[model samples]
Target: SLFRILGELWPIFGGNVSKPKLTDMFYIPQKPYLTVGTLRDQVIYPQTREEYDELHDSDAGLAELFALVRCSNIVEREGGWDAVNDWIEVLSGGEKQQIAMARLIYHKPKYAIMDECTSAISIDLEGFMYVHCKKIGINLITVSHRPSLWMYHEYLLKFDGRGGWEFGPMVLPEGYQQGTA
Candidate 1:
């Protein structure tokens, strides 16, 4: 499975090396065609030929898988490797939320359904994720009460105080339009 491949190669690709257990969160592909070292060699530059050869020789297949997983932002945080090792069992709600989002994106799904997935993240990170999704051209269905979330959405589905709903393309709030004019 893709997840298993990612799990095996994650350490080689400079991923959250401390959290070996957490590697399972990635979605594994059905067939094993690539390795961690191959991916690392393809995407990142090794300081020396010796380094590349070492990675290439060390379970090359898994190395490729890890390289792909390492591409996720959540896996590349400063001190993230140490954090995953020390706090894997005691991660905060926000950390867990971020992990789940990373797993979802690892597979590059055609469509995503996010039910308040960003509730635990700061507004800035939430905005960043939305922008990333847009750049990737992934269709998203996000559900959240935060007004700021609407800024990243192309359409809005609002539920009125009454037992009614309104659906339409998103419009800039009146305040924003007034300032521009």
Candidate 2:
């Protein structure tokens, strides 16, 4: 029954989505799914190529954001901002995560839902990123197993996978000393 329904719907959706004639009017609403790994794409790809070119052409603090993520050298190493169009091919996993964090910082959303966003990032850099996020007033709802992240968050939510869960103020592990500024 489901296959029959899908087979009927496929003809309708498939033609419109797979190939549209020049004059055919078709619109498909798409909801973007962005995760920690795809953050670099968010920063690199705008709604249009013109917007991306304009962003680099203009003094819109792109350099500062890159510096914030320790990616300033990437532009220089890659020959220029133009080279960043192929970030996925050129950047390392850690670098990609950094770029994603930078994108989050750039948008400055009031509340960010981050799931293991900094898993590839080093503890020192992760701390720096968290500090800046707090400084910029972006609240983080982070999902990570790393105990190093406790100092940055005010609350904790833990799921035991066996239908058990806990939520409360962040509890640091033993001998964890948050350093003074």
Candidate 3:
């Protein structure tokens, strides 16, 4: 199901991709397929309402998640965590990205392909996303050219655009090398 989503969304910004199969992938696809349910579902996506209930979902937990993503104000303004509306109509770009990060952290998949998912997010929230992924031991493949993100990686793969590429330990500007900055 998610592979089908990859097929749909990848072409918008990614290079060509073949039909993905479960066997060929490194990790199992455990994240729920994105769905439009309640406001809570927005943050714990791919999970059905029944699964959410069986997992003992709580407003306190949802509140904590909202706080971590720096969007609890939305819930506060909406009256409470139970307020379910069209978030897409209300959320800003950065807010949407923050929600995505919250969903990713909640899912905590073994592997994630974060293709510039944080581009719309602030650096602080982006850092939180990175830190949370590390804490959960998620193997992250972040596709971005933003220099600020270079510090998070041990290895760097630079493409020269003429079909040439360089893969080695990251080499960044002074005060920003791995383990230094």
Candidate 4:
């Protein structure tokens, strides 16, 4: 149920624009009754159902979906549903980052570049997102300073900060690899 809800809301949360065809994405084969509208109604409010449903039927829905997923918690607290309204402007930095991520996921790009995109998020949340990305087979090029972030990547590119750089397979060092150039 949660997965269905996530699938329907993902485009809205991610602000996708590339037009999702059934052939491009994979859906878990199970109950054949789960439509986008059913998923939306389950996770979102009934009053907001029409708006969420309308988003799936149009290209511009991607942007609107992104706004909703990013601001949904805040909007729900204040009793508002419109993702493009005044609520978006007041979201916190972390919330904004989440919104940006939601947009990217919605777009479902063949390749994604994450340039310090999760700087504002908690480490656990970032890890969770990365796992999801991997599950979906979205090729990601992530740039982050956090050592833990490297665990998600298959390769590593290190800049020595002295006009030198190294790129290769990631190796876990037995001890801190330090040198002065």
RMSD of 4: 13.6
Q: What is the C-alpha lDDT profile of model 1 across 45-150, one tens digit per residue?
A: 2224466455565434433333433334433452332222433344455655554454455444555556667687677676766667666676666667777677
lDDT for each residue of candidate 3 in 1-181, tens digit (9 for 90 to 100)? 2333553542335555554442222221223233344678787666766787898746677777778888888776765655677776767777777777777777776666666677876676677768777777876666676676776777876778788888899777877633322
Any runs in candidate 4 off by more than 4 Å, and if so which? Answer: 1-71, 78-89, 175-181
Off by over 4 Å in 1: 1-89, 161-163, 176-181
If scored against the real structure, what TM-score would every candidate get? 0.49, 0.68, 0.74, 0.55
Residue pairs clashing in model 4 are 12-65, 12-66, 13-102, 14-102, 14-103, 15-103, 16-106, 16-107
Ranking by TM-score: 3, 2, 4, 1
**Model 2: pairs clashing at backbone N, Cα or C within 3 Å:** none
Which is better, 2 or 4, measured by lDDT? 2
Which candidate number would show the highest TM-score if scored against the true structure? 3
Question: How many times do residue backbones clash in model 1?
Answer: 20
Best model number under lDDT: 3
Residue range with the least summed lDDT across 10 consecutive positions in model 2: 22-31
Against the unseen true structure, what C-alpha lDDT does each candidate score? 0.49, 0.61, 0.65, 0.52
